[model samples]
Target chain A: MIENAKVCLYPKNPGEVVRILEQEGRRALILAGGTTASQVRDPGVTTLVDITRMAPPTDALTHEDGEWFLGCNLRIQQLAAHAGLKQVFCGMLCDAALSVGSRPIRNAVTLGGNAVSVFRWSDPPVALLAMDASFDLVGPERERTLTADRFYSRHPRRILKPAEILKRIRVGVPSGRHGGAFFKFARTAFDLAVVDVAVCLWFDSDICSRARVAIGATRNVPWLSTRAARMLVGKRLEGKSIRAAARAAREETKTADDIRTGREYREQMVEVIVRRTIERAGDNALGV
Target chain B: MDIHVNINGQAVAWRANPGENLLDVLRREGFASVKRGCNQGDCGACTILVDGTAQRACLLLAGQAEGRSLVTVEALGTPAEPHVLQQAVVEHGAVQCGFCTPGMLLSAKALLDENPSPTYADVCAALDGNLCRCTGYKKIIEAVLDASGRLRK
Candidate 1:
């Protein structure tokens, strides 16, 4: 409830959005999907800039030159239902999108919202980081691109300027044998994840050439387990290597006690989910 | 602010506060079927169809409803001739407290409209957002399946 909002502007394009944000400064809020915006109680917010109308009307997902571009304004459900993405990365993105809230919530929640809000329980960031996606940001100064690593390095809000907007996400579709899997452990299907894991692997023949292991809901922000990923590279996707990688992920992650679970329990589950996700990703890569 | 929307096949213009949510505005305009349950999005009590897609009204600002088609449970059926889903719920004893019925019906309608022949898993997934505190989900699931069959026939 943006209590002090006295004006809601429906911007027709990015230029208009930037203009409004620049003019209103701290008093303006960007409303995308409104899932997060509806909960705003900030008394300082006096203007709402609605961006739904400015989103790309069609072809939410486009592929060109081996890179996939995802419109930020696309709904989570749309991403879940996208046939192109369903086939990409062994449908890991679809799984993450489907794992978001329920059907109604997914219908209203946008991909940009999920990415920008940066909640520990947010599902897409974990997968996006694992996939090494990049973001195209539009601002009053000039457009800039940031890798998922850099984008999620700090709170996105802190990184983004007042008038900047996340416009599109780009990921290179791996051409060779590659697969990814995302798993979220929650009390219920619709509950916020207690611990979530996403693993993406590229295999050179029977050997793992590259790997990415990302975990969320355990830290302030979802982060890539580089040590765990390093453990998988140059090793065969076998029991010994998988366990070692999972152990690294467990050790690298620092969990805290929350209302949902304890720190030790989360640490234990991280290892389990990481191992299983890696196995699933291996099977996906092999088409087994 | 003035926001215009097509509600239940009628185009109407209404005054809305910039901060007001669609749920409050809809109910204020006499759309009593749109319940104000959790105020938060967890409870699907304020579920409505925005552009034929089921969305929680509480999550949408009233200004965002402009230039969109909105549907409420009121458009589904009348007491004289209830919608097939409504009729099936009553016959299958799915209505207990009936507090979650409207939301359940709307969610079910959205599913059946898209998938005329849905399996048990599909119905379960569709109603996952709407919680039936009366613990009558089994009957409700049964009713949705039955209604899908009836609608197809």
Candidate 2:
């Protein structure tokens, strides 16, 4: 799709990447894992700034100051294979990462590409939304961080200026009887999700202290259902509370009929998936 | 544009376009083993090992292969000295029509390289990307299992 491109520059550092993007303006495209590059059909793109060699290669997952930092360049497979991340939030992040297309797709798709290209079927955003992650961004002028809620408020490509790059994703590791779960319902193992849900719960002596319920593929952007989450706070994670939260999630999420499934069916499945995901998270938190 | 890459352990400089995909470039360079099944990322017919990880060639830009080490199914083995995985596939009748075999073999090679003794589920997960309409995957799975055992010995 980048058939009209003229130059492909391998930038050795983020600064070089920023400069090249600035110099090329709309003519330059950043190529990380390159899995989605084939989808680019812009006729104006004439330069490709490859960033695989921008940093010293290391494990993309790192823990610092009670938070997990996922380098934007991290491949989806690397995120899925990280033993440390597998233990985080009951392996919700790993589950979401592994649910992406397939092994080869995961091997080539970067977390940054997945985040920046906000497709409706994207998986990691749902988990990140539920985890309340933050994105670190670097641009020609400054570097800043935005919460996942804000970062995903619109297409990340729109949020990022022409020279801006998503540097890393920061997710706080929950402590003290917390658990999370991600459930993706797809037509096939490799097909795009019909409806996906992510849930995180914190408990204090059997009472739900905090909760986050995020749904994806049902809307243009994945979103956290505050009303659904509110139903769980201060209530025990029993059948009654879980059902109420699931019902709220289904009601609040506005789904549209698509080629994959019907709107009413997706809305109904939302409730089912939310309840199941929350129940799984509750079980994980209780070590059941 | 010119890109330098280590292909099957041999360093080669290849001419390519910035927007062209790796599958077309490799095929044009006489690497017939890298088949083009689905130009999109959905089918893994063009699976190749980039820096020892299996990735789709069709989805990857040719420029992305610059400075990287790549291994296609051509590097696996010859007919006279077939790789154990190839031998197992032949013995298990896994090669019907043989179009997806190259991609499947590379995916399997990647899995076995990382985990020599992969479970049935591991093999399935590893080969999930490469779809085969002929074999129905039963023989392919069995062949991979047999090859894993032979490699362990």
Candidate 3:
């Protein structure tokens, strides 16, 4: 049981939420979708603050200045059904959202929870990391945006101050020719990922302009393989280049033994999945 | 705190602890249809329809259900007048142990409510959360399809 449990507060607005957080201080626990309780080993929480009401009443998905603003309260099921996301984000959001847990769980799990969850199975972060998504944070003091890397760089972290909450996620639509793919290898379709890979590539005529390869469940944090990504720049996305990049990703990735699989097996799966995801993305980008 | 929610279309009030889960509160309120399986979101035994969407009650706090509509398996039908899906389950011999039936029925109901005619893949996706250790899922899928066919007419 939650020791010293207090009343759950439903904040009407961002400012109200901040006020509650500021007043409660360390005792306040922000409950987005409430799925994190089961996974949390010891939730030294006192007060439960429900921020669902703090969400904007309008559309969760909006395009402003070439960037898409995704509300933090948008549930995974809504994200999967989002037509604009499916059209622009290259199905990564849908794939990741659909890949998380089961249909019932997905109905309640919010995109913000997935982004901030230390649980690696919270699938959207890897795909969002590859897509270079940034988070909009609102605190008692001020509001700012943090890149996905900074937001997820530490364990059990969201880069939010005690009274801060993630407001929205900003993802810039990649211009020109580009494609992306998210591949998760798990025991079952509903199970957590043993190894997951997300790859996004931009093609300039015959040469690849840019690439982002992110491997998840391989480390404490989802890691972007800069070496692997750099290997594809200015080179044709062919078998040789893809193989080198995948190998680089495998080399750069850090894995540890877990209940899911062994370290060596995860490393090997990472290489295999990274290669497959890159090839899939390349094929999609080339319209093949 | 005192929380009020619409359960099975009836407004009810109950005093709940600050962090009490909806599943526990529901089971205590005699809604035994909402089972307690893994207590985690992994299992669908505690599945219920919250505002027409299938969700696990185990993960949701009692306070979160305030002023929202909740439908447990009890709302579907009684033994005399079983829901069409329940009738199909019986006709197709879909209940082996019957522990997971409530969740499957609710999930299937949510799916059929939205899309009356669902394909095999759609049915599989809808019932992905509800795990039936018995019946091997073949008869369960067939039962859902049969219910869909019956509902259409």
| Number of clashes recorded per candidate | 0, 0, 0
Q: State residue A132's C-alpha deviation in candidate 2, in Å.
A: 0.9
Query: All candidates' TM-scores?
Result: 0.97, 0.97, 0.96
TM-score of the second chain, cand. 3: 0.98
lDDT of 2 by residue, B62-139 (tens): 888888999998889998999999999999999999999999999999999999999999999999999998879999
Please report the interface RMSD of model 2 to 1 decimal: 1.0
- Where model 3 places Cα greater than 4 Å from the true spot, the runs are A1-3, A38-44, A156-158
After superposition, candidate 2 runs with Cα above 4 Å error: none
Compose the digit string of candidate 2's lDDT tens values, residues A48-152: 988877675422678989999898889999898899988889889999999999999999889988888869989999999999999998899999999988987
Give per-residue lDDT, candidate 3, residue B16. 82
Worst 10 residues of 2 chain A by lDDT: A52-61
Worst 10 residues of 1 chain A by lDDT: A52-61
DockQ of each: 0.80, 0.84, 0.66
Q: Write the per-residue lDDT of candidate 3 for residues B12-127, one digit (tens) a residue.
A: 88888657788889999999989989988877999999999999999987767777899999999999999999999999999998999999999999999999999999999999
Best-to-worst DockQ order? 2, 1, 3
Q: Which numbered prediction scores highest in DockQ against the true structure?
A: 2
